[model samples]
Target: MRVPVVVKVGLFALAVMGIYTYYANSIPQIQSALPEEISLEAETVTPEQLVRVGEELFKGKGTCEVCHRIGQVGARAPDLAGIGGRAGTRRPGVSPTAYLVESLLQPGAYVVEGFPNIMPRVDRPPIGLNRSELWAVVAFLESLGGEVRARLDDIPKTAGVPAGEAPVAELKLPGDPEAGKAIFMGKGGCVACHKAGPLGASPVGPDLSEIAKIQTPEYIMAKILNPAAMGTVAGYPAGVMPPTLGQTLTAKEYVDLVSFLLTLKGGA
Candidate 1:
């Protein structure tokens, strides 16, 4: 008696799936959990502690290194090797602390020569560094080549509005969510880092199972076009999201992907 073709095909598919699942589970997993907000107003934090927290934000939430490099010149932004020491000198009338604070709150105001004025305001959404976070970041920058003189008051009161509540431009996407899900699992490479319901199990980036519930459609679209500008999600390393998704994907594909992402409202 000959074995049935259907049975053989089913066995082969199962074997392949088992191998893939085993390999995925065997790899090192890195979950990108969201960072908790820090409030310095109520707590008494020392300068040393502040600087430490500032450094973490720079690499994590602030997402400064995505463009600005320390000790090395960057392609996107200026090398901040001596920003602290020369910040005061950049604008003769302004002090170093004031300069740093201004630079973070209003990056486009003083675009460094040779680099485009693409740096987003750190206090704005996506990156959304809060007042306390901004204060610490300035302290960290000052430590590079100048003294730490930044205070809580240095950061503008209006800066660092929480991103979730911020107003976003209304978008009307005209792409199929089902096709977008296919692209997400195949060409988009999002499944490798993010977990979107049943599509993925990777822990490399933040779980996007509930992304639509928390983020606005405008933010999602902008983030796809400019990951660095949107800023790194807290707890995830900076520069991990590819910045070329906007260019690599066709306009329709981009819209479809965004549409699919919008459907991921958690709990499937």
Candidate 2:
């Protein structure tokens, strides 16, 4: 007896699915996981070890290879083959270490003649490198053709600040600014480091007196979730902002805090 057309179609579908499943299972399974934060503050690392770590970060977490190429010209960024040796001479009266640190921290401060100001601050969230990582990366870059003399102190205290440009569109959060302000001062302990309009008076972190005016809501939210990825504000220390705020606060609490921050518009 002839089988129904539906049965034939079903069988074909089953076979296709089975083949796909088998093929998927046969291939190597590669899982992409987020890079873990590394700190060498307390650890004693040699120059060689530091360079190795820096190389890994550049290729992996630092994402430097995305735009910067060594030896060859890049479409987005300058080739870094001899950036170490060339860094000092690029600016008048600037040391190689200082120039490199500034390039990483405040890329827009001095744009290379042919390149656009597109480099992100390395010490902030998204690429939120700590002092240790920054030190290592600088050393790695310096080793390209120059001396590896970049120290932990070379990176400025306020190296990473959220980009000053506002978002194309604003986000409307369903949170109470009053509640967020309360959390900032009391439960969140943000007031200990940051200076908001009237709630906080701390000098340890960047002043948020006008954060809402300068940054996008998306940036503020992302910074809260992943401060390292967002980058540090210039003139502030890296890694001081804990990366645990997303995990520590409830959804409402986080939203409320962001709303409160958005209210801060310096002189606006």
Candidate 3:
């Protein structure tokens, strides 16, 4: 008996789907890993514990291991071996601990010789770390070859963000600052390079707490829409910010983020 054309077609279709399913399953899947929140109870954490957590952050959330190496030469960043001892000498009048904080917060402040300035502030988004986590990273770096004297106070708190609140830019722009903040910390990922508070204190938040007070409203708007045209900050890398930011965000998101940024008076 001859198979009906419809039945043969159905079988072929099923076989094609089966092969597709098999092929798809055979291919390895890729997924981006989001960093886990690192929380340390400061009152109860010990120096050793801090170092361990710091190591974890260095390896994980901090993403330092991507460009840094413990004892080997880093093609991207500097070899961190004995960095604790050498950190003080990196800059005159800057102590080992102070230098570490500065590097984590203001990566462009000091670029290592022969290395391009590309290190992002660990306290900012993507790697957004709170004060305690930043302290842990510093302690971890110090543990390599120097004294782990990094203190919690070394990290400064943003003005209005200490309470997880956005600053009162009180601008006439019609956008929700709170919603914009969510975009900053969420979709916009602006917190990665700029801080509008809420990242939790000094060295931990990437330190752009006073953007509104320092920048004019017109400049802020233009900067967000066309960063390359606005020009880079003195110490930061040129073209570091995404030029596609305006394209990526919805109009409301862009407005909200701008309104939120305008409110960041850094406690006036």
**What does candidate 1's lDDT look like per residue over 118-207, in tens digits?**
566666444567778889999999988898878888887776643233333323356789999988999989999989988789977777
What does each candidate score in C-alpha RMSD? 15.1, 20.6, 20.9
Better of 1 and 2 by lDDT: 1
Off by over 4 Å in 3: 1-36, 159-268
Q: Among these predicted structures, which one has the highest lDDT?
A: 1
TM-score of 3: 0.48
- Which should have the higher TM-score, number 1 or number 3? 1
Q: In angstroms, give how far residue 53 of model 3 lies from its true place.
A: 0.1
lDDT of model number 3? 0.65
Ranking by lDDT: 1, 2, 3
Model 3: which ten-residue window has the lowest total lDDT?
Answer: 159-168
Among these predictions, the greatest TM-score belongs to 1
lDDT of 3 by residue, 2-29 (tens): 9765455435434533553454334312
Report the C-alpha lDDT of model 2 over 37-155, residue by residue, as the tens digit: 56766788888888899999888767676567888862346889998899989889999988888888888888877554446666643355667778889999999999888776786
Ranking by TM-score: 1, 3, 2
TM-score of each: 0.55, 0.48, 0.48
In model 3, how large is the Cα lDDT of residue 203? 35
